[model samples]
Target: MDTATASKNPDTRSATDRGLPWAEIDTVLFDMDGTLLDLHFDNRYWRELIPDEYARLHAHEPELARQRLFAEMERIRGQLRWYCLDHWVRFTGLDLLALKVRLERHIALHPHALDVLDTLRVQGKRLVLVTNAHPEVYAFKHARTGLGNHLHRVVSAHALDCAKEEGCFWERLQTVERYDPQRSLLVDDNLAALASARAAGVEHLRGVRYPDSRGPAMQSVDFHLLESLAELLPDRRLHAYASSPV
Candidate 1:
């Protein structure tokens, strides 16, 4: 059965499958950090190591350092600088990127992320890595994950001069990477970015319910949530990966 027709029929398997309708999607925009790679590295870096190190350097109580840093982060939470490592270095007087690179051992792909990308690549999908990460951060993660090899293009918000949380990001993204919003799908863990995509007319959105495997459950309330990218695969491939040695 055709995709649209299959989606309409309650008895059709497509209705039961949570995977994207590949036939209808042309370009697949993926969020690199939490959506593809495990988010724990960033979480631990920002929430744990940074705080501990900052407290050590500044001679402040551990709790005070975390509280101070959290307040500073809140002030620029959804802005581009929030993702800027240079800005963080200047603000915190810390060599953030070097610290991140040192923590690269913790960087890893989410389960089945590679398999899903392999399937999409062979199908000739336009896979784009769209991220709010600063270029330095992107480079480090790329070194660890080799995500650049699999993507048609890698876009950093710094290059666009806008964060994904902002609505204009989609328009700016098109200036460099042309895509039909209605025929595109974005798998992102950030709710703000998903909302921005929806507002910009992107047709499909999937949110990661557990972006940080080492952390608690995340909120993906307005958009469809996937427990893992494994859910994006067809039953046959999913079972194969599950049974295969990790």
Candidate 2:
């Protein structure tokens, strides 16, 4: 695919035109939630359901429970523990994994995400799923979405004892799963993770413009912004696909 012309909109086209060496990319790293899958599930689970469950368990008002939980979440916002269900279980004295299993219905792939995955598979790209999600959380989502079947490997940042935001995480990741940073592309929803990967020398980087399907689109990004995964499809195929009915 010629990324420059495959962009879904003018803003994305402008970003793609900025000399991205897409032809040289061999390894494609993907972030799980938001990048490939819809992020609404995670947002609602953490912001709404968790607070409601906490209130039910603690005999507190929903608003009070939300305040307390939000405070704790904020304290560890960017830390590894923030993505760990085991850490949450210990912190909240609640079975988080079980709760997640019950809420599995909310899990879903982003629009045209499967189409993009299929295209990458056909193109023989080395696909890798990288996420900050804890092993239990990753397992649940992987099982629910079957995203693992499409990838060469699934990596949890917890395995490296660091969040993707940390430079050390990339170093640790390289040692475990070797890939040339210069020939690789990483598509992630988190700007911090993309920045970390860039610092680690990953050549091609793309960010999802709307990580949360129900939320407003992001303003401007330093790297290529993908409005839809369909934007990565081959130009001729994309044109035909777009013209087809839903």
Clashing pairs in 1: none
* Highest-scoring model, lDDT: 1
Question: What C-alpha lDDT do the candidate models reach, one value each?
Answer: 0.81, 0.79
In model 1, the Cα lDDT at residue 161 comes to: 90
Worst 10 residues of 1 by lDDT: 1-10
Per residue, candidate 1 scores C-alpha lDDT tens digits across 121-227 of 88778999999999888888888788788888999999999999998899999999999999999999999999999999999888887788777767644888776
- Estimate, for each residue in 185-225, the C-alpha lDDT of model 2 and write its tens digit: 89998888999999999888889888887877765548777
